[model samples]
Every structure is written in C-alpha cells, then in structure tokens.
Target: MATKGPEVVTDSKEIAEIYKEFSKFPSLSKASIGPEVISQYGGKYCNIYTEWSQRDLERAEWVKFCRQYIMFYDEDSIVYTGPSGNCTELQGELLTEESPSGIFKAVLRKHTNKKGEEKQFLEIWNKNSKEKSINLSGLDMHGKVYEDDQFGCLVWSHSETHILYIAEKKRPKTETFFQTKPQIDMTEEDEDSIKPEKQKPVKGDVFVYWEDWGEELVKKSTPVLCVLDIESNSISILEGIPDHISPGQAFWAPNDTGIIFVGWDHEPQRLGLQHCTNRKSGLYYVDLTGGNCEQLSSQAKAVWSPRLSPDKCRIVYFEGDVGGPHHRCSKLCMYDWYTKVTSTVVDIVNQPGEDGFTGIYSSALPQNCWAMDSQRVLIGTPQRSRKDLLVINITTRNVTSLTSGSDAGSWTLLSIHQDLMVVTWSSPNCPPSLKVGFLPAAGKEQRVTWVALNETKILPGINWKILTFTPPLEQKNPKFPAMNFEGILVTPSEREEGAPTPIIVWPHGGPHSVFTAEWMLYPVTLCRLGFAVLLINYRGSIGFGQNSVFSLPGNVGSQDVKDVQFAAEFVMKEEFINTSKVFIIGNSHGGFLASHLIGQYPEFYKACAMRNPVINIASELGATDIPDWCTVEAGFEYTTGQLPTPPLLEAMLSKSPISFASQVKSPVLLMLGEKDKRVPPAQGLEFYRALKARGVPVRLLWYPDNNHSLSKVDAEADGFMNITLWFIKYL
Candidate 1:
C-alpha cells in the first residue's frame, strides 16, 4: 500500500524556501557563444555571446531581458563583461553569420510566434567600417525566418554579393467572397473600381487549412529557398525547387555557382521535424547557371547538416534510416564535390570500443566544425550519461575523445573557427559556462586544455557522480542483446555515509532520449533539499551502442521498466539511499515510466509526479503528432495505412501505464500543458480521473498557454515548487 497523501495548498513556507534556494542558479536559457569570430591578435581572439535573464518567474508575461556580451580570450584569462551592442532580439531569436572574406556579417532576427507579413529582419554588418554605426538593416521580408537547425541556413556567397537562407514561404492573401465591396465613391484615385472590375475575392481559402511541420516547428509550413543581394538591395525567391519538397539547411555552392540544400518530401504526408532526423529528406543541388535542380545524394531516406569542409572540397553530413526510432546512431559520410563520389567516414557501431567509445550519437554538426587541416571534423555526441566531442579524421576514420575520461561534465561545440573552438561545458552541480580550446597539432587532441570564458558557479554542498549499472547477462531478445547502462547520482555532500535521506528517481523523457550530465533545474533543486537524485539513462538510450538502442523496441513497458528499477536497486545497495522515502518524477516518456513504477510496484514509491506523460498508448496513437512513434515503440515498424490490429491494440494497452492503474496506491501529481500537441492533456486527465476514482491522492496542474516542454517561466518555476512541496509533504 502507498503512504497517505497531502492536501492541495496554494502557498506554503516550504514552497517559498525551496523556491528561494533554487533561484540562486541563474537560468541560461537563451545563451550562446556566436558566429565564428576568427580575428586573432597576439594569441588572443575576440567573440560575441548572448545571454537571457528573466524578470521574475512569478510573472505570466512572455518576454525576457536579453543581453549581449563581447569577450576576448587570451592564453591567460578572458574578458567577459564587456557589453558591445544594445541590439537585442527579445521577441525573437537572433542569428549571426560572418562572410568568408571577413568584410561583412549578416544578422537575422526571427519573430517566431507572430505570422504577420513582416516577421523577420535581415541586417548586414560592415566589419571594416570606421563609422560609429556599422550595422545596416536590410529590406523587410515576409514570413518568419527558419532559425531551426534542421531547416535553417544563413550563409553569404563567396562573391560577397548575395546571401542565401530558408524561411516560411509568403502566404497568399485571402479574403471571404461574401464580403462587401468598398463603400467609397469612385474618384480618380479609385479608377480601378469605377472604370474596371473590382478585385476578385478568394472564395474559400480562409477556411482551407495548410498543414505545418508539427510540434516545435508549428509555424513553419512551406519553406521557400530565397536569396538576398546585399550589394543591389534586392531579394528574390529561388526557382527550380520542387513544389512537393520543403527545402532547408541551404548553403552556397563553391564560387556561388548554385545552392546545395536538404529537401524533405512532403507529398504524401509531413511529420514533426523536431527531435527527429529520420524523416524522408534528400540532398539536392540547384544550379543557377541553368535553373536545374538535381538530387546529389544517392539512395538515402534521411540526410542532415551538410557542412562543407574549410577547403570546400568535401561536404560532410549525417545519414540515417527512415521512420520507427526517431533518432539513432547515423552514418557520417563525406561527399567529394569534384569527384561526385560519396564515402562513409564513420559507420554505425554495434558495440563500444576498448576505450569506451560507443558509436556516434550525433545531435548535430556545427557550422564551422572543420579543423585547420580540413581533413578532420569535431562531432559532439552523447557518451553514455554525458556528452563528448569526438575529433574524427575523415580520411583515416579514426576517432578521439576531446574530453578527458575523468571529467563529469557535458561538452558541446557551440562554435568552431578553424584552430580555435568555443564550447559550452556543464555538469549536474556546475552551472553552464563557456570554454575555449584550440585544436592540438595532429594526434594531440588529448593534450588540448580548455580556458574558461565566463564565471562558473561553485556549490559547496552539491556533488554528483556517474555510477555504472549492469543487467543480468540473459536473453530478452537474441537480436537485440542486453547491455550495461549508467545513472548519474546527485547528492548533498553534507549527508554522512549510511545516513537516512529521501531518494528521488528521475527517468529522462524520450524513451529514446538519454539523461545527459548537464545541469538540470528540478533535479538539482531536489538534491539541494537533502534528497538524493538518481537520473538514469537506461539500456535503450543513445550513446550506449546501436545494439542497446535497438533492444528497446518490442520490449517497451517490460524492458525499460525493469532497467530503471534495476538502476534504483543497484544504487540503493551501494549508496546510503533511503528506500522507505523513495519518490519518482518524470516528464513525457519519463512520466510514462514513473506511472509504470508506481502502478506495477505500488508499495515502492511514497509519491509520484509526471508532466505530459503518455498514459495509454492506444488513446494517444491517433492524437499524438508522431503517430509513427506509437507503431514503432510498440515493437513494430511504422507504415502508412498500417493501423494496429485488435490484438496489437490490446498489446499496446497492456504496455500502457493505465492498464495497471487500478493497482496503484501511490499519490500522483500530474502536470500538463493544455496546448501540448505531442501528448495531449487528455492523457493526464485520464490518469487523474482513474486515480481520483480509486481514492488515491492525485492532483493535475493544467497550464493553458504552455506547450509540450512546459517552458514558460511561471509554468516551470511553479511546477518545480509544487513537485518539491509534494515530495516534502510525503516525506
């Protein structure tokens, strides 16, 4: 049986205290170290970075206080406090790009939510100008700019005369046909209405719906390849792009002869593009000399992030299979522009190397990822529980870990400029901060040391360590063998050995996504309140070899549930984990597991919390933006017109947490975003009603204005506070 639950309270002193303690950690939500700044002088280089600070988490407003910082990095220290520009994009995202010749830089501000005619701004910066103001705002354009990595590309031509980018195509004007004509009397100014026929009104375009890319890319419907001539102050939409395909990740061909981009096929259907790389997309090169467009990539279902080498001789990109598991280890291949030959630089790894290097779980490649030699590229990937940057020799196919094996933090390449690289490193206890490092002289990647750019937070009581957990070497599935997984344990250092303290098990969302070793607000907040947190990255998680990832399918509810339980039990035996006061919290798929933990093992947890969790797979199948996720996760391939059979649907229901809801006794706190398209709020309501009917303590928090992430300032802050209070009350 589960422990008794607490009554719903609007405010409490405990909530206030926890909120104040968690607020000390600054939120680096919109922070980034920018566009490749290669200006070096006397072993020192300059760069631009932006950070956003919220006014107050209590406010429901939708704006942020954004600040830009100019920093200089030298062999000794960094100058990070200089504020250079007052130009900030508070309402949208600011994207910057520097020209090859270093004479010009382009800045684009994408107004994300609004779809008005003028939704984006393109500005050019004259780097060599002597005037006080070197930023020149360019012509206003239609539709929001494509700032997303999957479809966004902003590059300047080699000729230094034009800029190429991708954005939502301009929507045609629509009006109701039943609308009345202008009531003004005819005059010389209105000769068109008097002497000629009135303009025809669109009959039904107002009610016609055009499907968007779904989820995070909701505003992005039809992408149009466009070019801007800064020298002539003219912008034109590029022709020759197929009408059935949506273009993105565009770049200029050598010498500005044409443009190369990835085109996603949207003819039959268009699925959500966010967090998914296995969509049906192909590489295409459009020739300006003859307006000819040709498919450059040979047979491939998905290809992404085609980055040209520094010499422009090779185009390197990531390729993956189509459908099913949204993300997996993809093949890294290089396209020789001159020879028109494609060769794999790195293939999928079934197992880890002797050095503990699993195959590349590439998130994405940086714009300037090439080293000075151009034969090498730096790829950032999840190395088990943490992120690691691997320096791969394109020619030799040899890989080296850029980060030391002992480091507990995650390292991501923010921007790479030739020999100098800008990286963001953070751990569970440390706040996210920028670090700069230089590429070592060939075979010396292990010797490279990073210089800290900004100030790092030092928490005296907070400490985190990575713990490896192994499963029994038995056959669950022969083709997909079992593998060892790891979990990150965060604890307060003040707690003595074998001391009694509450333990919280945090499983990451995305049955596919792993819990990275970065600073997370809620997990750390719980740890600060004297609770130990075990963030587990189970067997099927990325960075754990393709075989382990493949093992997840067909065994979703049983395999993943046991792995998390095994992780908790493994840690409890080794650490001073308080088993009696154990709790669980999760968002999305993590929520799915939390539900399973409490339902299947009712007496294990004192209380539980879930955010936008998938409760019933059968109910969510038709509503979720990724319907294919339903088919693939149930241990089957996703195919159009392949709805589940009755027995299959029953199997899916059995895999859902709702199937075991009647056995649940633990108090459940559900947080849902009403506007979420991924997992609708109804899923949470279903569980809420079931728990309520069973007389189990349950509360549902519904945020109307938020999305799947619950990223709004008030939603996140308040949600964390409520979760903390609930755990405290149960304890």
Candidate 2:
C-alpha cells in the first residue's frame, strides 16, 4: 500500500460535466430476433426488433422506440441493398412473440398505467389485416400477467387458437372488520380520545435459505399457468397444478394436448423467484383438458429450459445439482416420451477436445435452444475466458464452435428459423448489434451477416484494448488441482506516450458468475475517463468448469483474494500502469471480494467502492434471501431451513469482510440500494458505521427505489458520476 494520500479536489461542476458528456453515448436496451418467416400480403419476410436509448442518467425514460428490420431474401441470397424497415413507438413492452402459422402473430405486452398499476395482455393480429386484431387481457379473469425472466416466452397452441402463459391469481380480500371499524359519537376534537384497535400481523411462511424475492408482482400472489383463447377472449387457469409448484416458460406439448414447463417447488410464504437458483425445481408436463400434472425429471434434482422437439418424439432439458449454485455445470439430457427412457447426452464435466481446449456449456441455456430440425442445439459456453456460441448435435454429441476471432466476444441466440439464425454479438470494444446468418451444416463453413439497426455511437474517437492475462502457478491453491484462471485488462486507446494510467480492479458479482468480454457501460466509461480497468474472473467464477466454480464455495475469502492480488501484480508489472493510483470496485459477491482485497492488502489500494457488498456473512445468513449461500460458500454441507449453530456462525464470521474492517485504511464508498434484499442495505450500514468509528474516511449513497441492479436511469447515472468523482478525489 502507498504511504502517501493524493491531494483531494472536490469539484461538483467538473463531475457534473463529465457525466453530461458521457450521457450522450447511445446504449442498447433490448434486442429480439423475429421468426424466420412471416407471410404478409403473399410476401415472406423476417423481422428483428431492437431498442436503444441515449445514455441519460438523469431522465428515467430508457426505451423510446423499437427499430424494426424486415429481411427479404431470394432463393439464392438475402438482399441488403436499401433501408428495409422503419422505426415505431414501442407498443407497451413486447414480452413474447408467437407466429405459428407464419400468417398470424400473437404478442404479449406489459403495460403500466400512470397510476402505477400494471397489466399484461395478448394481441393476436393477422399479417394481412392490420386493423383486425384481438386483445385478450388476463384482468377479465382476475389474473395478473407474469413472466419468469426477461426472455420468458408465451407459447401458441398447435392450432394457434390458445396461448399458454404464466400469471398470478388475485389475492384474497381482507375481512371488512380488518378494513375499517365504526366509531360511535366520535367528534373531530375527540379523535385523539379513541384509540384504534391493534391487530397482530399475520405471520407468513418462513424462508430459510433462498434468493431474495425482490419486488416482483408474481411473488405477492399465487402464480399459475393460464391459457387464453384468442377467439373467445377467455382465460382459464390450468387446474390440478399442486399448490407448491410455480410453473413458468410453458410451451404446448406436441398434439396440443398438454403443456411442458419448468416448475419450482415454491413455499409461497417462504420464497420468491428473484435471483433464485438453488430451489428444488424440475421439468413438468400438465394436461390442458384433463388437468393432469406429471413430473418428467424424477431422476434429476433440478432441471430447466425444457424443449420438445418439433417432431414431438423426444424432449431435451438441462440437469444440475440442486445443492450447488444455479450456474454449476449442467448436463444435457434427452427423454424419449415413447420409450420412457432418459439418457444423458452430455455429463456435467468439462470435456476437453482433441486440441486440449476444455470448457462447460452455460448452465442457463437460451429459451429457444433446439434447432429447426431438433437434432442440434445452440448454446453459449465459456471458452478460456470469453463466451462463445456453439452448436451441439444431439445424436453425435459433437460440439462445434460457430464463432471465433479475438473480437468474436459474446453471442446470444435470439431466434432461429430453419437455416437462418438471429443473434446479438458484442465485445469490450464493439457495441452490441443484431446479426443474421445461416446455420452451419455438417462439413460446411457459414458466415454470418451483421445488420445495422442503429448506428454505433462512438465515444467521440475514444478507443480501448482488451488484453487477457493468466496468473502464475504460485497463485493456484494446492488443495485443488491446477486450473486455468484469467483476467481482462482494459486500457484506453490513446495514452500519453509513457505516462502510467490509473487503474481500477473490478470483480463481477455472483462469485459463481464469470466476467466475459462483453460490452459493459461502466468499465467503458471508466476507460474513457483515462483509467485502466481490470476485470478479474477469479476461481469461483462460472464457465471455467465445475471444479473451478465449486472451488470458491469452500474457500471464498482466501482463494478469491489471492487470485485478484495475482492479477493486480501481473498488471502492475506493465510500465503503463500507475500502481500508486490503483483502486477497487465491485458489486454483490464482487463487492465481497473487493472488501476482502482492501482488508487483506490494506496498504496496496488507494480507494475502494462497494455496491451492495456482503460485509458480515453471519448477519447475512439470517436476513438475506439466499441464506443457503452463507452455508454453502463456507464449505459447509447444504443445510438451509435450519437455525445456525455457534460453530456455523463462527465459520461465516471468519470469512466475512467485517472480520478485516479494523485494518481498512483506504477511503471507501458504499453504494447501496435501499430496496436491495440480497445484501440488505443494513450490511453496508454496518460497515459504514465501523469505518466511521475507526476514523476512516467513508461515504454511503443509498438509492431509495432501486433494487440489487442499481441500473435504474437516475440511480445508474448518479452511481457512475459518484464513483468517478470518488476515484478522482482519492486516487
């Protein structure tokens, strides 16, 4: 650690100006690839929807317009000669799309009123008749529309008459006596004389170890599967789904007799689905007409992303350990409905190819993973340190990499039609953009064509280089076998000849999550502000392999901390880095690592910024939604729903950042979301008070309305500005 502190400069005006300049850069909000083909007026076309917003930190309106691209292709080639489509004001927020027959389209939209009430409805429209459309709102049947995740889909029946979706049933009404009590002979002056009767709060089910429920609408009510009849505008809740099962991502089974979905065995009063990966979940099939529900994954403890082949012969799903984190290695399995035999297509181990390149497929596969022929599946996997797009043949079980090159970066498969695949590609240097290409067939090489829906807004001549680094053997823990771990160094495109640039070490959240070479606004902003950013994908990060990710659970503080230190040392050796001005910033689990780094290496860093960090694991075990996180990460057996013992508490405290609070000498900033339930605001406050009592310079900024992701318009903008100013003053 540096012995001398830099001179402090508090210039609110300069900070405001820096924020104003960067707010002009456009950023991607959402992107969707439409169906492979849509028949309109006897013409076949493909549609792509993308939403973008100017980086406005002050204004809350993030999405304004939806840019649409209609692709017209000939038998020989696709035409890319002129402007293909136009932009329109987005109709509510497009939730899901279903174009079963290619002539008709069904879309779900989530609309919120000025009063803050939200409603989700389905719109069925004919491709040829723009004016003829049917609106089916769940409100008519006292059901509230809901979706499991951002990419959650709505499935249309084989005949395209009914849509299967997940929704919440209305809560029961309170008794009239609880609502109000009549007071006799009470005058205005006597209002204080009459005391209101106190009613004891209704106790709900207790959540032991689970993810934070946050403030999702579905959590407050009972979630159920609902089928909406487009012609009758009638909605029927699928019955016989056990009360403990919360079904989502429902798709119509072959022949339209039943629906297949991933269902979580939820304790309504105990748990909510936000950020939850450790729940007891499985793939299930529910008959629509007879209302019979069947568990399809009896052999696996947890399963997700179930896909039925178009031919309706086999089913594919991902299976993983329920005891481990949700992002652990997932095995691909196929179930034959006719033979009732379940076979593992791929095990949960990282398989090395002939070239010795080893990796694991992402645990959370895309909703549409099955190919048009149902013989291949597209998946995103972590290779080396970056995310790549790969396709796996179900029969041969051969995985082929469809993307390469240093800039290939991360690719998300949005929609695929027969031969054409629509995806979004992004990297540290390149902004995210939508692309179209033909799927690679066996023994054939295919090239994808990029489409420009919106112009990539360059930060006015700003350039950056993303370099990868691997730590030496000494950084590895002897307890675990040797594994590959890497970090990314992001340096500004232009530097004063030999001047050393200040650097910020960033560790991503989800100690189980990996930091890919994807386009992120925060690190890019820091680079543009003349700072080098190092993103360390320490031992516990996902995508490396099951062993690496599971390694951190039992050795959180020590192993992860060393990985970061090694990364810093490796970067410091570079002549262009200012070791004296090094700072640290992280969120959630990343924040946990940052806190540990500052404490363990008190003299090494100049300043530290933590966003919703886990300060005291002992206290967190009781209040956090994921209490199991504490037990599992502490190297203890998975024991949630049980009270913590003295020994367990001791183990958690030993690994907590609070254990090192007394040694922290660097000025720290705590960015907390008041509404955050994951690492409750209390955790930050505990550390803040401790640092203040120790006479250390510390500041805490709380966003009252924001949750874990402080990415809300105003909160995100303000956070960026505050961190920049904090680093400017201290480093």
Candidate 3:
C-alpha cells in the first residue's frame, strides 16, 4: 500500500466536484466473447460489452435517456463489422446467445414501454437476421419476456431451426365474484331468442389473488416454454412441463431432440429466485417430438445449471440442500447421458484444504465454457477477496485453479473457442480488461498465459492488499470449522505519519455474497477521496467453504455483526488509521450489521450509511419478497402456510438490528429503493423513523424508481456521492 501524497478534502462540498470528475471515467464492459468467425475479422476471438453514461442525468432524463457503449471488440479493439452479429447498434440489449454451430447469434433488446407493458424486439443476425417487435398482448402473450437470470435464458437449437425461451403465461381473465351469467331469452313477439338478454352484474373475481416470484422476478409467474421456428417465424408454447414447477436456465438438448432446464418448484409457493441457488428445483429433459418431461436429476434435492459438454455425452450441474444460505459451496455433479448415471465429481468441501480450493461458489457458468477436448469446463468463484477461475474435468474430477489466491484480483471466463480461451481480469486498481489465452494441460491448469486485448487504465494513486482475520477461537462454533475470513484494504496512493486516514468498514449485501476486491466504481471513487476502505468477507460469506457459509444462518445478528466489529478493531490498531474517525457502511445484510454495530458499540463509529438494509426481521417477514429467507436464516426450515409463532417472532426480533436502535448515537444515512421487493423499502423507513424519534442525526434518501440494487445510473450516482459526502462531513 502507498505510504503517502494525495490532497485531502476538509469540506463535504468538495465530494460533489470529485463525483463529476470521476463521472468522466469511462464505463467499460466486455461480454459475449467468441472465436473469430471469418478470417477477415482479425483477432483470436470477438466480444461485446458496453461503455458509458454520465451520472449527471436529470431525474426525468433518467427515464428518457440511458446510454452505454455496447460495442464489439476483437484483437484489434475495433468496432465489430462481422457477419455473426452486430450488437453496437442496439440499445438495452438483454440477452445474447450464440448458436451451437456458431453460424449465428440471437439477441434480445428492449424497444418501448407503454403503460402496463414492456416492449422488446428479438433479432437473430449476422447480417440479415430479422428484428421482430410485437405487442405481446396482440400475440396473446401475457407477461413480458423473461430476460432476467432467474427463469429466463435464451437458447438456440443445434439444427439452428428454432430458438427456445421462457415468458410469463397470460393470467386467467378475472371478474368480481357473484356476477350473473348472461342468459338467453325468447322475445315476446318472435318466441325465439335472437340475442342473449343482458343480466345485472353484481360482482366477479376481479380481486382474486395470484403469486409471483418476488423481488427481481416479481412480475414473472407460470413461465411457459416457448419455441420459435426460425424460418416460419412461428412460436410453439410447449406444454409438457409440470404445472407445479417454473422452468428457467433452459438449453437445447443434444441433436435438438429435447430441451434441458432447471425447474424451480412453486408447489407450496414461489419464493424469491434472485441470487439464490438453494431453491427447490430439478433438472428436467423435455422431448420436443413427444413432449415427454423426464426428471433427469434427483427430484427432492435442489439442482441448477445443467451444462451439456461439447461432445454431447455428458452433463454437469450443481447440487445443494433445499434451503439455507441462498448460495453456498455446492457439490458439482456430472451425469453420463448414455448410462443414465450421476456421480459427484467435486463433493462439497466442508472445509477448504490449505491449498484453498473451497468447493464451487457458483453464480452461473459461461454458455461457452467447454474446452476443445469437451472434457474440461471453466467456471469462476470468489476466493477470499478475489474471484478465481477453475477448470473442472468431469471424467477425472480434477479441478485446476487458473487464477488462484488474492493476488490475482479476479478472473472471469468470457468464452472458450477451440482451445483458445477469453477471460476478463480486473483488480482493485485496474478496470476490467479482456484478454485471449489458451487452457493449460488437463491437471496442470496451475500455470496460465494471456495477451491483453487492450491496455486498461488503472485507478490513480490507489493501492491495496488482502488482510486476513479469524473468529475468536472461544466464540467459534464447532460445526462451522473454517473461521478465517479476509478483507481488502484499499488505501490512497500516499501515506503520512501525522495524517491518519479515515477508514470505512464495508460489508456486502448477501450475508452470503463475498466482497470481491475488483474494480468497482464506488470503492475506487472512495479511495480517490483519500479514504481507506476495508471490504469484508465475513464468516458466512461464500467461497470460503460450506462450513464458513453455514456458520451464519442461526447466528446472523451476533456472529456477522461481531465479525465487522472485530474487523474494525483489527484495522484500528494499524498505524495509519484515524481511530477517532472510523466509520462503517453496508447494504442489505451488511446494513443489518452496520446498524447493529453502531448500537452495540455506540462510541466507536463516527457515522454510518446503509442501502436498502434489513432493519427489523419480524416486521420484514410479512413484507419481504423472500419470506423464506427470513425463516431459513433465522434457523427455521420454511414450511408453506406456516405463520410466525410467538417464539419465531421473539427470535427474529432479537436477531434484528432494530432492537439495538435505542443504543445508537452515531448519525445515520439510509439510501432506499422504493421498488425494492427483496428487502422492502419499509425496512429502511422503519429505521429512519426510529432514528428520527430518538433525535439521532439521520438522513434518508428515497430512490422511488429504483429497485433493491439502486442500479440506475442516476440513483447509483446519487447514492455514491451522498455516501462520500456523509463521511466527509464527519471526517
């Protein structure tokens, strides 16, 4: 870390100026990587990723204009002019998937948004792929297209004759109950009824109830498997899927004979599907010719992401329990298609070995992760403060760490073509950059090589290092063995003996989500402001082994909270930290800890800020989209139709940060998204109102149009700047 020289800001207003300057920093992203199609298009492979939009948009402009450079790049770093696809022209591109033969690309793009409807167009293009945008209501399509990670993945068949996707089924038309039915009556003069007599209507089932997948998938329900015939432009809503399960992550089966997908169970009730791999789901193969829906994986256990090898003889997937930490280190299991057998290739690592391969903390495997040999697959997972790439050979069960240890920052497999692989790497100081490389020998993936696509700009004067900590041995749970966790300490370029820098203790949202030390805008901007940031990976965080993750379920408020508190204690002892100006920040579960910390250790923190935080579990249970989360994380197995008992309520309240509100003295800032369904906006409101009642210095910022993430460029800008200002004021 740098020992000393950047300028310091004594005024909070200076943060706004810094925000505008940082806003000029270009936004770059690289995705949809593929091998060179025609020799003419130079480079080992091709990729599509977006660039920038100023954070200075007016509120109305936020809705009117959203811009980002969704450009294409190859070895030359030039705009894509290839015949396979042209993504640079489209805006709001949702999902892009390549065909098995790599002859074409299918892209989904948002078009317009009329009241109660979301308009989008689907295109399959190299040069002449048609762009079709139709009013879903005109086509009798019910809900908007499923373009999210949960239940929607666009897929193309091997024959290239059809494409398959998921969309919400049109709900049953309803009316108020008790409405009279139309009746036929004979006319007095003709003695024959020419028309049905109008009947007086009283009521109908207009207010009838139906449930949807909460949070990000709130409007999605009862998804139908849609197959589109390419040549005829006709769609077939395949009907063999069990009505009890909602299908997602679908892919075309071998020879395009059937479709393989993960079917999430909505039998009892649908729960939130975002950021959760533990939902009860099964791997199913649905035959296109016969509509035969066959359960390919164990029906009772939760399974997801079934990737068929390039050779088409085998499949690999993740297996976990029905519920717990929404995501954890899961067993990677593979199945032989011909033999109809399944085996655990990488069994769950209860505790990582000293070498540190801590099972698989799956997000989603790349669509093109297969190597040329078809025996190995590449996937990325968080390892301590960094994200590591690993190659897993299903046949041999040998796992190779492509980018191991915290020093590498993070490695994401974009796509692999023939034997050439495309991966993106980014660290605390560097922005994400695309690179082309080749996979190493089978068990020897320990060594790797790469050629950068373009030079990446580094965050000026920024430096960082990974700091490790362990749970107090006496307080550690015996069941959860791997107690050591890590944090990324980001310091400004310069250090001075007399000027100890203010440090922010930042924790992640998942409680299970690992805080990767990558190039994120907010943390980097904070570092540019001369603040040291400690991004924590608490005990229950994923990527550190299942034992570490399973440790926090029944122990949330206490263990996770103490971990943050102890982290601060660990950092405060450092020579360059300003103990008098220590502050904390968290979002979601991280917020839960921040609130607890301020209250539990009243005099320690100078101030605190949280976004869409969980304030009161007891109150949040009835409002949150993921009530299952409330029950499971509170040490109870969620059962459908189970109401909270007095004991459950008591336990939840005791575990909530709200209980400690009275003891809090530090000023607080709450950044909330009104549309957030995961952790309802009310959660933050509850805290804001409490702090108000107690006369604690508090400020609440409402982003009415944003969701749980406050992901809109404007909202993100608003929140980031305010957070900096809040801390600046105190410092």
* Per-residue C-alpha lDDT of model 2 across residues 361-468, encoded as one tens digit per residue: 465666556677778877777765677777778888876777754244677666666656667777776677666676756544234455544445444423444445
Instruction: Compose the digit string of candidate 1's lDDT tens values, residues 422-480.
Output: 77788898877766777886787887767765678756677889988777766245676
Q: How does each model score on TM-score?
A: 0.89, 0.87, 0.89
- Give the C-alpha lDDT of model 3: 0.78
Error of 3 at 1 (Å): 18
Which stretches of model 3 miss by more than 4 angstroms?
1-4, 10-14, 21-30, 33-89, 113-118, 128-137, 174-203, 405-407
Q: Which lDDT tens digits does candidate 3 get at residues 1-731?
A: 54557655645567767766665544333345444454464434343333223344444232222122222444333443223333233356677677766568787777656675556666787646555443333456445679877677888888888889888886545556655667656557554432222223325656656788887776687888888887877777887999899988898888888989999899888888889888888999999889899999997889987888889888888899887678888888888888999899889888888777888888787767788788888888877677888888877888878877324688888667665666778888887766666677787676565666546877678888889988788767778654788889998868665778888999888888897877777887788888889998988888888788888888889888888888889888964788998889998998998999999999999999999999899999998878878987888888878899999999899999999999999999999998999999989999999999999999999998888988887788789878878887887
Candidate 1 residues lying further than 4 Å off, grouped into runs, are: 1-45, 48-93, 110-119, 127-141, 182-199, 473-477, 496-499
Instruction: Sort the predicted structures by lDDT, highest score first.
Output: 1, 3, 2
Best by lDDT: 1
What local lDDT score does residue 366 receive in model 2, on the 0 to 100 scale? 64
Clashing pairs in 2: 1-603, 1-604, 210-625, 210-626, 463-493
How many clashes (backbone atoms < 3 Å, residues ≥3 apart in a chain or on different chains) does model 3 have?
A: 15
**Superposed Cα deviation of residue 595, candidate 1 (Å):** 0.7
Each candidate's number of clashing pairs is 0, 5, 15
| Each prediction's whole-model lDDT (CA) | 0.79, 0.71, 0.78
